[model samples]
Structure formats: structure tokens, C-alpha cells
Target: METARSQQQTAPGAFLAFARFALCGGGVGIASSFAITALAAWMPWSLANAAITVVSTLLATELHARFTFGAGGRATRSQHAQSAGSAAAAYAVTCLAMLLLHQLVATPGAVLEQIVYLSASALAGVARFAVLRLVVFARNHAQTQKPQNPQQPPRRHAVAGAAQGGLISRSESVEVTLAS
Candidate 1:
């Protein structure tokens, strides 16, 4: 029964995590696409795309680390590296898709190129989310099972004073009773 209840609770938590990932990923994608398109107007398409990918990936990594994966600001160096690696994998997929699309249509228009980029980015976002959840920020079972900050002092309780000699002050007595 406890296991079933825990699973039920975790299901909502998992969905919330996925929702955060998607929200952050979508924001990054839109910003990256705009930057890429603008750069492409002034520079070579491939160069602009690559530059934007790196910048956006870094932004997305930080966002995912803090918001999506609940890593707070304590992500380890290895985790950061893994996040970057996942970004690279996603970038590779987008680049490959772009290449394939270019091959299919010679001299594709700017609008068509943008369309392909957005499509590829959407697909890569899905892949990136999976990698981020499963590999980059994978939670260890032991860590989850263990209490955090075990070395820290336990919380003080007013009842502890009353237990000693009923010597607690009026405020402490009220606190203890309220706590009970």
C-alpha cells in the first residue's frame, strides 16, 4: 500500500518535471532560432547556426540544471559536462537534419530553412529532455533514500525542555502543545 501511494505521488512529480523541461526547452529554442535567423542574414548560415547552438545550449543547460532537474545551484562538474554532452548530441541531430533537408531541396528559401531548423530543434528537444533526466541528472537511489544534511543538528523542540523538568517558559509550553 505504501509502495502504491508513493508511486502515485511520484507520477505527478514526474509530470511536473517534464513540464518544466518542456517550458525551458521551448524558451531556449525560440531564442536560439531568432538569433540564428538574424545572424544568418549577416553571416553564413552554417556559422550562425553553430554559434547560436553553442550559446543556446549553454543557456538551456543552466536552466535545466536549476529548474527542470531540481539540482539547484549544486550541479557537479561532471553533471555540467554531461549536460553539455547531451546538448552536443542534440545539436548533431539538428545539424544532420538540416543537411538532409538541404540535400532534398536545392537552394531552399530562407523561410524553408527556418522551418527545417525549428522542426529539427523540436525533435532534438525531446531527445535532450530524455538525456537530461536519465543520464545528466539521474538521481541515485541511495541518495534519495538517505536523509539530506545528516551531519546537521536536529531541530530543537520545546517538548525537550518540558521533558527535562517542566521548566519550559510559557511561550515554549504553548509551542510544544501546538506542535503536538
Candidate 2:
């Protein structure tokens, strides 16, 4: 059963998680903005955006899995793929925002373009945070954070579980054990 303290922890925990997500993902987005611009000097804008998006998504997902979501380890391939979907959405939003900016103000100033792009990126980041926390890393975080049943005998696993079990299961196992 859930205790009062555990319940309280949920709200703050989520807030902290979002904070971390913003830090890691936002940092990557900011850097990628510059990267995409630099690459555009050598290639088409769309290709630059595509390349930067792919790289940033990979980097951000790993940071999120390890530090932001408290997944306790590296990200899985499945998580990376799900994260890419959200990243694609973000890329679309940024592209559309820039496109609209150009439509309204032909030959927009660089500052104006940056503002519009970053604003759109911020909006998409919020949605991406939800998707990442609740979807991409949900199972990983849940598996890491399960409370132990003190009354029951300790759980064992055939995979690479934690070296010791106390009141909880800290196993990093990806394998599911069936009860006989």
C-alpha cells in the first residue's frame, strides 16, 4: 500500500525529474541550434537540421535515461526510438515556427529567428518531457523504483541483479522471472 510520504514524494519527484529533463534536453537543444546553423553553412538547411536532430536526440536520450529520469543506467534501444519520435516532433515544430516567421517577416533578423525557433522548441520540450517520463522511461524507472514486500521472501533473478538485496530490488535485470 502507498504511504503518505511516498505519495508526497511523487509530486516533488516529478517536478525534480522535469527540472533535470529541462536541463539535459534544453542544453542539447541549445547546442544543436548552433550546430544546425554551423552545418547549414556547409549543407542545405534541411539536411543540417536532420543531422543535428539525430545527434542531439541520441545524446539527450542517454542523458535523460541516466540523469534526468533516474532510469539508473544507460538507455535501451526501444527508449532511444521512442525518444526519436518526440525529437522528430520537436524538429517539425521548430521548422514550422521558422517557416512562419519567414512568411510574416521576409528576411527576418537572426535574433528574431532564434527567438521564434527557441520558443517553439520550448513548447515541444514540455510535451517531449511528458512523453519521455511517462512513456519512454516509464518502465525503466518503475522497475528501478519498485518497493519491496518486507514480509515476502526476497526476490531472486537469473540475470544481472544487484549484488545485495535489502528491503528492495535494485536489480538491473531486463529479464522477467516467472513464478512457479
Candidate 3:
């Protein structure tokens, strides 16, 4: 059916959107990791990581709206808030992983710490993608896109017949139909 074909086409578009989102998210994570590493030299590791996470999350949120979700200038305030919430979730995951890693290896070297951070970020990326695609942008995209099939107004049909006094009697009925 036409509906099935249209849905098949939409599936590919959704996949492509997810692919773009992952790529952009990965790039942002890498950049943020580098910034965090640099900042760690001057500040406490946790403080540096937190500061970079906030800035990078804001930047990534905007980038995701513009490029990943193709929302561009049309992204709503609520959508942006959702994006920020997703980032916060990812950040929490990363931080927790870092805490666990530090617990296991009490005094990890700088390189080891960076490795742990990047690994945690990669895991968090998957969560971020799911939240962004399924929660933040899904409904908005569906609402903005036109429906595959639209319902047409009901049609009226009339029939006329001769009456006893040479007057015409008319009967009318409504027919409902769907547009392809």
C-alpha cells in the first residue's frame, strides 16, 4: 500500500538523521574531552570536567538542532530544554564512570584518566542519541512534516424524482472518501 511505501521512505530518512546526529555528537565529545584535559592542568579535575561539560553541552545542543535534527531556526524552547536534559544525562553517566574508574585505580596517570573519560563519553553518546531522537525531536518532527494521507471533506450526492403534483422531490446523502 502507499502508506507502507511512504513509511519505508521515512525509515531511511530517520536513519540518516541518526547517523548525522551521532557524527556531530562524537565530534563534540572529542572536542570537549580535549578542552577538559587542558583545563585539568590549571584546575581541579572535577571542576575542569564540569565546566567543560556545561559549555560543550550548550554548543552540542545548538549543533544538534541545526544539523542533526534539521530543526534549524525552528527548534522550540522546550526542545532545547530537552536537548539540555539529554546532555545532563550523558554528563552524569560520564562522571559516574570516571568516579568508578578512579575508585578502581586510585591514582591513574593523566593519559589513563583521559582514556577513561573518552570511553565513558562513547557510552554516553549512545544514550544521548536515543534521548535526542526518540524524546526531544521525534514528536516535533512528526508534527512539522505533512501527513502522507489527508482526509477529504465528505461529498454530497443528490437524486431528484417526479412527485404526484409535477413537483420534484430531492434526496441527498453524504459520501465520505479518503484521498490517496
Candidate 4:
């Protein structure tokens, strides 16, 4: 059977998913920036950034599962773990870019720093999208489907016709079963 999830994995579906991903992830990223700035006023800068990243990642993963990839419900623990892995990579990417900029330039202006960070983050975000689509949330999603009661077997109805010297029997209906 062609499931809605399978349909969403197609070309148009991928486009829609990418759009939703941009909206959700971008929104979270923007919010995280402001949140980190505000929180930094009260706590250590590093601690504030870490706190915002954790909260933003949780929000983004949930949005991706439900709205971006159309996963039909909340994210699973496995999905959260995978998303965190990708987010960590993205964090490392941005951090490394800044470190490189500082080492190469004696004094880089705030504008240059923002450009480098945003560029690195954009690259990482693209990679994260692919990982989320093809790795983290790639499943049949059949669990959402209801199953027929195995205890009550399907009743078969048939007809028997006369043959040359015996009986010819055939089922009027066909029963098909699929595994996995």
C-alpha cells in the first residue's frame, strides 16, 4: 500500500519538507540567537548559549517531526538522539569557523564575524536537513496504522463447479498478506 509517509518522501514532498525545515529550523535559530543574548546578561555567555541550544534543538526536532517531515506525531527518543548528534556537528562547524577567522585575522570586525558564522551555520544546516530526512526520520511509519485482529481470521467464501469427473473449486475472493 502507498502510505502518506511514502508519498511525502517523493519529489514534491521533499520540496515541501525542505521548506518546512527552513521555516522551523530558521525560526528556532533566530530565536536562539536572541535568547542567548538575553540569557547571557544573567549568566556566563557560554552557559547561556548552551542552554539556548538545548532548548532550541528540542523545539526544532519536534517541529521537524510533526510539521517538516510529516511524521504524524511527536518525535521519538531515537529521533531526539539523532537530531542532537547533528546539532552538535553544526555547533562544532560554527565554532571552528570562528576559531579559524580569529587565527587568520589579527582583528576581525563584528560584521566579518557574523558573516563567517552565518555562512558556516548555513552549510551545517543543509547537512543536518539531509541527515534528518534520510537518517533520523526515515521509517515506514506503519505503527500509526491500525491492524486487523489476528484472532478472528478472515472467513473465506467460495464456489464449487462440476468438472469432468471431479469437483473444481476456487475462491471468489483473494486474501493477501504483506510482511514489513
Candidate number achieving the greatest TM-score relative to the actual structure: 2
- Estimate every model's Cα lDDT from 0 to 1: 0.70, 0.77, 0.70, 0.72
- Candidate 1: tens digits of C-alpha lDDT, residues 1-180: 112223323432557878998899898898888898899889977788789877887777778777777664556777777877877777787788789988999888877877888898888888878887877766532244333566643233445544467555546522111111
Candidate 3 lDDT over residue span 57-149, tens digit each: 777777777778765445677887887787777778778988898899978987887788888888888888888878886765554344435
Model 2: per-residue Cα lDDT over 84-118, one tens digit each: 99999998998888878888997887678778878
State which candidate has the highest lDDT.
2
RMSD of 2: 7.5
Quality of model 1 by C-alpha lDDT:
0.70
State which candidate, 1 or 4, has the greater lDDT. 4
Q: Per-prediction TM-score, please?
A: 0.69, 0.74, 0.69, 0.67
Please give the lDDT score for candidate 2.
0.77
Better of 3 and 4 by TM-score: 3
Residue-wise C-alpha lDDT for candidate 4, range 54-152, written one tens digit per residue: 888899999998888877679999899999999888888867887799899998876686577677877988999999988887752433232245554
Where in model 4 is the C-alpha error above 4 Å? Answer: 1-12, 38-47, 140-180
Q: What TM-score does model 4 achieve against the real structure?
A: 0.67
| Alpha-carbon RMSD, each predicted model | 8.8, 7.5, 12.2, 9.7
* lDDT score for candidate 3 against the true structure: 0.70
